[model samples]
Target: MTTPDKPGLRERKKQRTRTAISDAAIDLFLDRGFAHVSVAEIAHAAEVSKRTLFAYFPTKEDLVVHRMADHEQEAARVVRARPAHTTPLTALRDYFLDGLRRRDPITGLNDHPAVRSLTELIYGTPALIDRMQRFKAGGERALAEALCDTTEASDLTARLAAVQIIGVQWALSADNFQRLVQGETADGRYEGAVRDAEHAFDLLANGLAALT
Candidate 1:
């Protein structure tokens, strides 16, 4: 293979490895529960050494949860790439509304029984909950930095705004997930979530003005 072909092959191989690991981990987690499924078991199921699994996912929780981290980065990117006239809040609102329209899992539109079980497992497990908190904190930090780069808001103001934005998203996601867990279909809450998100962002935009 030429140099370009070499990189393409490497990328494809890495993706295959990642998919294998994630598929194996999810299967084991759903079959036996997240707590009962060890990294060794996941590696064995994927036919990879434990070291290879670790190279893909640093922690067992990551096999299931790091996807959320990727989402946060995408959100930050959207905000950063917004039109010059657009506000950070507006960009975030649009991003979320788009997700809602698509019935994205990040907006808690998931219908899979396994996904619901995983959500419950994460909430019920103290360690997973802690990891989630840290993930949120990291996302907030990245968003704050992005906001600061785009707005004239003071450092504290930008950070506070980022926190408020992320918190609203978190609440909305949790509410949708809880509704799903309670047997409500995505169709049941789809319109409600969009309306609620609009109101939530409106409050943030107006509240910031009031504080100033």
Candidate 2:
């Protein structure tokens, strides 16, 4: 098997610049709210020209939501990379628990002020919500395709698993986000969140059999 080549120094620097721009944009958005901020203001704050900012982010909303892309294909990746003996659900269970421990933002376990503010901004903005829905659709498709690669699963089976897997992830994290938005502290809920995630994943892994 051929290993994928690592990004060159130039590519790494470009990613750093992109992250810097997004961080700057989120900071600005949080300071004054997303609707009040402009592309020019974000570009200026990031110390990049408008053209350069556009090169990195296609739309103003993309600046805040691009981070979603980082984990968007994760479901597919876990399935494809899992040990041959491991089931896809088991692989995802382990990954999700690790994210909980690390306070991964996607897991919605992270409660940094910036994280909360950005989530609130996205939830408040209709445009961003629509964009994210489309983004997640692509992720689901990727997961289905990955599941198809396994001989044990039929297309119907694969699609069902893909949908259920993504559904659990979105549902669990969303509950946490809503709680945080309602004034709950991350540290306060950390233990319960971990237990909730565990229960959610256990359901996925064991299904009705676990209920019996």
Candidate 3:
């Protein structure tokens, strides 16, 4: 996809406010369990009114996962923006590989302490897990729509293909995350992650290429 223009001053100020709120919430959630924290406490820590906090983040869970939600449209954007000669699968594979190379947290190849802590929090909390699932579902729908629009595939085909692709991507990311949690460095896991990603995408191509 084409790069988005920089936000104007007003939008930048809003983003800063949102970031402060999210940071405050994460600090509280990480110090105390997610269940123990309250939205009022977070708003107090961030120095924002409850109404403003709610405006930026509709729910408590959102304050933590808004970072991940930012990326929910990534796959669809890749598919929609791929070169004409490239298959959607190929474009997605390339995009994922680039993420791996950059150690992008979305690829689960990042071992930054903050990312790990947030991941642990998400996995440990039921509400956050549920929210994450909803985000994934939204991502899948967006990708399926992109597949239909870009490939002229039937709705069913696009949906099924999106399911498989998203599932594979999640599996790959989880595996990488698990390895990092087990003490492997991202650099150490890079080769295996790349190998697994390539194999996974090849499997996808075998099954879905004809339809696309």
Pick by lDDT: which candidate is best?
3
Better of 1 and 2 by TM-score: 1
Lowest summed-lDDT stretch of 10 residues in model 2?
203-212
Q: Compute the lDDT of residue 157 as modeled in candidate 1.
A: 86
Check candidate 2 and list the clashing pairs: none
Candidate 1 per-residue lDDT over residues 98-184, each given as its tens digit? 998888777787777766777777777777888888888888888888877877778898888878988899899898898888888
Please identify model 3 stretches exceeding 4 Å from their true place: 1-7
| Every candidate's lDDT | 0.83, 0.83, 0.92
Q: How accurate is candidate 2 locally (lDDT)?
A: 0.83
TM-score of each: 0.91, 0.84, 0.94
Task: Kindly list the per-residue Cα lDDT of model 2 for residues 74-115, writing each as its tens digit.
Answer: 889988998877777778888988887888889787799878
Best by TM-score: 3
* Residue 46 in candidate 2, Cα distance off native in Å: 2.6
lDDT of 3 by residue, 110-183 (tens): 98899989988988999998998898899999999999998879999999999999989989998999999899
- Cα error, residue 1 of model 2, in Å, equals 40
